[model samples]
Target: MGIFIRILGAFVLLSATYNPTRWNFTRWAEANWGTQMPLTLLFGLLLGVGYLIYIGATLRSIGAFGIVLVAAIVGALVWVLIDYQILTLQNPSVNLWLGIIAL
Candidate 1:
């Protein structure tokens, strides 16, 4: 349960910050900057803090080498999925799938 929650949190944070859709924080901030500067800054800082916490925990748990290894594994998995016709690179949702796999 804890692991699932952590993954969910990371996914939410990542997608909320920047995604293919225009409903994310970056898009929101860009569209409302002039009228909502203060709120924008506040949310930006909050997001920054959330990133710091997650990044710190990830580094502390796995270190840089582990991160690289994990990335390599993920890359290989994606390749295998493509090779096996399980995942199609041309699909629009592949981006979202990749993002989810990152968690």
Candidate 2:
């Protein structure tokens, strides 16, 4: 159950970070604030901090190695799903890979 929650959390985090139709900060900034490097940096920092917090909490509950193992499983699952067209992505980029690894 704990591991399941972790997996679900990882999926949610990845979606929030990478899904353009969802909570994609980069897309939002580009549309509203224009394509500026400073805004990109700011959004990146915010996302990075959020990722750290989420990872820290997961690590606290699962330990370092366990977290890594979980991340690997989640990443592989995501990659396979995307590759097989189980998950539809309009423009999958490095962020998708990073999000999977971060999960």
Candidate 3:
């Protein structure tokens, strides 16, 4: 169940990336069908909330140190992938700057 929630959350996060409309209700509704907008928002929110809850539960089962280790590993993997251009460096310097700020 926890694994399922994490996968669902990842999917939602990916979808949200494509639909910048999520942050703007009027633009979203105008661009997409009203029914679709509501459904998308509901699913995205549910996935996001479920993912965080499940990750917290799973991390608790592991331990605090495990969470830190996992985060570091994932961060390193993202950096490597981006550096290698295996993952499109969308905004290039801007993205690197943003990443620095995020840390």
Q: lDDT (CA) for every model shown? A: 0.88, 0.71, 0.61
- lDDT per residue (tens digit) for residues 1-103 in model 1: 9999998899999889987888899999999999999999999999999999999999999999999999899889878887898877677666675756576
Residue 42 lDDT, candidate 3, scale 0-100: 75
Report the C-alpha lDDT of model 3 over 22-54, residue by residue, as the tens digit.
Answer: 454334545676659777677557666865775
lDDT of 3 at 27: 49
Give the higher-TM-score candidate: 2 or 3.
2
Every candidate's CA RMSD = 1.9, 6.1, 7.4
lDDT of 1 at 95: 60
In model 2, the Cα lDDT at residue 67 comes to 74
Candidate 1: clashing pairs of residues:
none
